[model samples]
Each structure stands twice: as structure tokens, then as C-alpha cells.
Target: MTSQAADRPEQVASRRSKLTREREQEFFDAVLDQIRECGYDAVTMDGVAASTRCSKSTLYRQWKTKPQFVAAALRSNRCPRFAGIDTGSLAEDLREAARAAGGTSDKDQGLLQALGHAVMQDRELQQALREALVDPEINALRDILRRGVERGEVPADHPALEYIPAQMYGVLRARPVIEGEYADSDYLVRFVEAAVLPVLGLT
Candidate 1:
């Protein structure tokens, strides 16, 4: 026989009565802001409820747990850095992407850093982070590379293509850790022009 718990609906539809799309976004924003300021381990359901002016039961009914709630927030809050970017030239496209990524707000970086430890420990959070932060940018970068190949600007099977995303993203995150400096637009653009373009022979 199917267990009642197993058969239960994903969310309590009746208890979810109070939430609207706008209101739900507010809750998500509140939770993310708190996480950025307090770190994931320090944020509490009560704190979220109080700050959002919603009852704790509402959050519990919606997400069932803190990790789930945070994961949802992360996925919902993603601001895709690369979308609808094509500048005809691969070099310009990459420079544009660098500018966009390097323009990420300190708040965004803080939230990422705050979740770093928890993401490693929680599979769901890790998935949410990748879905939110990694996949879109990688897909966009791949599109840029593919377009270059089609234009005869780069080789179809260039080995560096596979590692381009990793290199750019790694350096962006690593700069702050290693040098206490956010990878600003100028720096990222220069890095791309110097390191990336030269590698692909697009320089």
C-alpha cells in the first residue's frame, strides 16, 4: 500500500492560500538578503518570517525546510549575466560578457560566499546554485564559441573551448579570495583580451 506521507501533495494547497506571486518573491528576497548578511547557518525560519512579516508556518508549509527554502530563493533570484548577447565579433562578444559578469554587485558576491560552505554539504543547494549561477552563463559562453567557429574565427575542435568557461569563472571568483579585489569590468576585459583571445588565436 502507498504510504499517506508518500502520497501527500508537494505543498499544502490550503495552507498556501495566503501567498501571491509578488508576495512569494518578497519572501524569497527577504530570505536571500538575510542569508547574505548573516550567512546560511545563522539564518532562522523565525527571522525570515519576522523580516518578511509572514508567519513562520507559511514558510514551513511552502518549503518544508530551511535548505529547500534557500535553494528556491537562489533559483528564483538568478539574474542571468548572459542573454541575447551577439556582437558579430567573438572578441567583442567576450568583452561584453566580461563586462557584464564583472559588474556583479557586492551583495551578490556576498550571498555566493555565504552559501559556499553549505552548498558543499547539501546536494540540493549545490544543484540550485549551479542551475542559478553556472548553467546559463556556460550555455551563453558556449554559444559565443560556437558562433566563432561558424564564422571561421576559431577551430571547431579547439581544445581551449572546453575550458574557457572554467577559466573565466574561476578567475572571477578566485581574484577576490587571492587578492581581496573583485574582478571589475576593466580587469576582466583586459584578462579576456590578453589571456583568452590570445589562446584562441583571435588576438
Candidate 2:
């Protein structure tokens, strides 16, 4: 067999090995839903297989371990929810971001709480969680702040800029603990209008 003939079979095999996007999304959704319904410790590849009606070996073949599988699922669900949020005013930008974050706060917060202990125990899981959920919002918030500075709305040396991400994300996690409520869109928008904007000297 010539080199091109030998390569054809390998390429065909590689193509066959990959799952379609819709199928992969189904798996990701199934695993995350399981994690939400059952705690991270209670979730398993076998459970996901049963839930999705696939062979356990199929999941094991794609991801060697539970953590790896969960991490991949988390990553697959990643969306830059806070990206492309320029509204010509930092205050408005932040309010928009708050609304955006709050829209999924219940589900995302529940997932985070479910995975909290496990994530603390696994560095890969922690990083994956941050990549999937945390970093994108932080990066987008930073972009909003950077734009504010550029527009002279806020000084570049303002101390509050450093803590904006913490403040924004903190409330989403803290409200359930403090007030026994999930920070929904209305609540988050109110938070931005009341607590966040004032601290930054914006209306």
C-alpha cells in the first residue's frame, strides 16, 4: 500500500471517531442536568450513560474519568454571556451585564453550589469551571471598565474597578445565603442601579 492509501484509512477512522455537535451537546446537557439534580459525588459515567441511553464504554472512551467527563461537559456548555456588551456608558454596560448574569443565575448558581466541594478538590475541575463560567464574565467586565476609563467616565486609578467582578459575582452566590433568594434579573438590575453604580460614582 502506498502512503496516500495508508493515510486514507486513518483519516476515515478519525472522522468516524468524532461525535456530531448535536449529539455531543445532548451528552453535555444530560451530564450537567444530572449534576444539578444529583450532587457531583452522586453523578457517574454509568448514570449519564443510562440517562442518555448510550453504552458506558462510549462515555469512558470519550473521557477517561468522571472529573474529565464533567469538565468536558462544563466546557461544552460554555458561552461568553457577557461578551459584546458595549452600551456607550459603563453604568448601562454593567446593568446589562447584571441582567445577563441574573438571567441564568439560578441554574448556574445551583450548578456551582453542586460542584463546589468537588471543584475545590480537583484543580482541573476548578479551572474548567472558571473557564466555562467565571473567566468570560470577568474578562467582559474588565473590558467594560477599560472602556469607561477610555471615555473618562471613571479614572484608571479607581480602586473600585479591581473589585467589580467580585462584587458582581459575589452577590449572585451570596443572595441565596443571605436573603434566601436567587438574584434574578430584576434583582440584579436593581442591585446595579442601587449598590454598584453608586460605588463607582455613576448614575
Candidate 3:
């Protein structure tokens, strides 16, 4: 067999010998906290190694580059905020979604802001951020809207339907920048009731 094929078993064995899930989550948590504190460009593998008390080589073996490491950490940290909301009313579903989004930790928002510049420059980081932070939420929001359409609460051809995710997420991400406060659950629910539901004739 070729050298690469011959090495596959040993590689898999070595990977299987890596840190347990709990230990790896510790590493990921350290990485995210470091990124929040230091910004993406400033966080180093050595810093993560020192903070998490793991050998730098261990990190390098698991993720060869800093971008890859950060991406993996971002993916690991994802918590789907918009899952399993079946309130049977679009307005209520959205309000519940807003409440969930607002309840998310400040560290999440901070990490996205911290990595914003770096993500623009690295395709992998951007993909990771979208996969971890963006896609699941967007998909869930779409599901909510789809359910609304099925229930005849909103028309599928409504122009505003396409922009619901953007509108909600944009405000969620922008509120801290513009207003100097995280958009908490109350604010989000109010916003949805006032701005979003009315537009769809739910109000």
C-alpha cells in the first residue's frame, strides 16, 4: 500500500487517543474566552496552552493553524437559540425566539465582534462563524415563518417574509453598537410585537 494509506490507521489511532469531550470543551471555552479578552489576532496557541494547561503541541496536533482552532472553537460553542418553538402562532413563535436570542450570553456577541475582522479575511473562519452562529438560527427562523405560511397567518408572497431573519438578527447585533446595551428579552419581544408582527398583520 501507499505510504498515506499505510499511515491512516496510525493517524486514526492517534486521533482516538486525544482529549475527552469534557477536556476538549475546556480547551474550547478557554479559546473563546481568550478571543473575547484579546481579540482574534492577538490570541496565541501558547496563550491557550498556558491558560488551559495543555501542551501547545496538543493544540497544534488537533488544529494546525490558529484560524482553524478558532473556527473549531466557534463551532463547538454554538447553541441553537431558535430551535423547537411551536407556539402555533407566528407572533408568539417570534416572540419566543426573540426571548431566546436575547437570553444568549454577552460572550457570544463579544466573540462575534472580536472575530469580525479576522472572519472577513479567512474563508474557513467565516464558514465556521456562519455554521455555528448564523445558519442554525436562520434556518429555525425560516421554519417559524414557513409554519406561519402553512397556517395562513401570513402570505408566502409577502415581501417582508424574506427579510425576517435579517431584520431580527441585524437589530440583535446592532443594538449593542447603537444603543450601548444588549437587546434583552423584553426589548426583543417588544420589537417583534411592534415592528415585525404588525407588518405581517399579526398585530
Candidate 4:
């Protein structure tokens, strides 16, 4: 056979490698879905392998442990929906931001709820989840609020401007469990008026 004909096998192998990578991603997503459905404590690498039709060793090779695998999965799924918070007014910007952040995402919120105990027990998991899911969004929201100060919509010295994102997110994350109500648009607006807007002197 010609050398060009021999290269056909190489091309086929490369295409197979691409499919392998895609299947690996599918396995990871399936594991995350099982965790969300059954809770983290209920999931096992062996179980994931059985469900995904892969070897348990494959999962271990890809991610050292369940925590490591879950952390990577959480990182992979993080989305930056709050990157466009410009509504031309601080109150409106904040309202929009709250809308973007109000509801828990299906994967994220479920993973967070399930992994809370696991994370508390594992320092690596705690750090990984915080860096992956929490820190980037928090920092970006801070920057959005800082721009509001620059635009003079909020006073440079406004305490609320500095703390609003944290308060809003903290409440949004906690209030459902603590108060049994979702952080809907109306509730978020009320929070802004009673807690945030007054501090910024807008109310």
C-alpha cells in the first residue's frame, strides 16, 4: 500500500480519539446528574461506572476521587449570566442582577445543597467549589457595583453599594431554606428598597 493509504488508519485513530473525549464528557455529565438526583452521599464511583457503561477505574483515572470529580464537574458547569448588568441605573442594574441570580440553577444549586456537608468535611472540596462556582461571580458582581459608583448612581462611600451583592446572594441562597420563600422578582425588589436602596439613599 502507498504511504498515503497507510495514513488512512492514522486518520481513523484520530477520529476515534475525538469520540473518546466526547464520551468522557458524557460520562462526567451523567455522574453529575446521578449526584443531583440521588445526593452526593448516595453516589459511588462504581455506581457511576455502572450507570455510564465505563470502568470504575476510568473514573478514578480521570478524577482521583469522588470529591475531585464532583468539583471538576461543578467548575465545568459554572455560567456567567451576570456579565451584562448594565441597565443605566444603579437600582435597575441591581434589580437585573438579582433577577439573574435569584433562582438556583438546576445543577449548581442541587450540587451545592448535596455537597455542603461533603465540602465542610473536605478542605480541598471547599476550596475547589468556592473558587470554581462562587469567587468568579462574586468578583464580577463587585465590579458591576463599582461601576455604578463611578457613574455616580451610588455614592462612592455608600455602604450598601459595597455590600449589596453579598447580601443579595447570601439571602437568595439562604432564604428558601430559612424562610420557605423563593427570592422572586417582587421579593428581590422589596429587599432592594428596604435594605439596599435606603442604604444607598435612593429610597
Off by over 4 Å in 3: 1-16
List model 2 lDDT by residue over 30-82, tens digit each: 98998889989999888989988989998887888999989999999889778
Give the RMSD in angstroms, all C-alphas superposed, for model 2. 3.5
My TM-score estimates for the predictions, one after another, are 0.90, 0.91, 0.91, 0.80
Give the better candidate number (1 or 2) by TM-score. 2
Q: What clash count goes with each model?
A: 0, 0, 0, 0
Candidate 2 collision pairs: none
In order of lDDT, best first, we have 2, 3, 1, 4
- Top model by lDDT, which number? 2
C-alpha RMSD of each candidate structure in angstroms? 4.6, 3.5, 3.7, 5.1
Task: Please give, for residues 1-203, the per-residue lDDT of candidate 1 as tens digits.
Answer: 65755554755454346678899999999989888888999999999999988789989988999999999998997777878779999988999999998888356667789897999999999999989888888888989888988999989989998999889888888888888988888989999999999999987
Report the candidate with higher lDDT, 2 versus 3.
Answer: 2
lDDT for 95 (candidate 3): 94
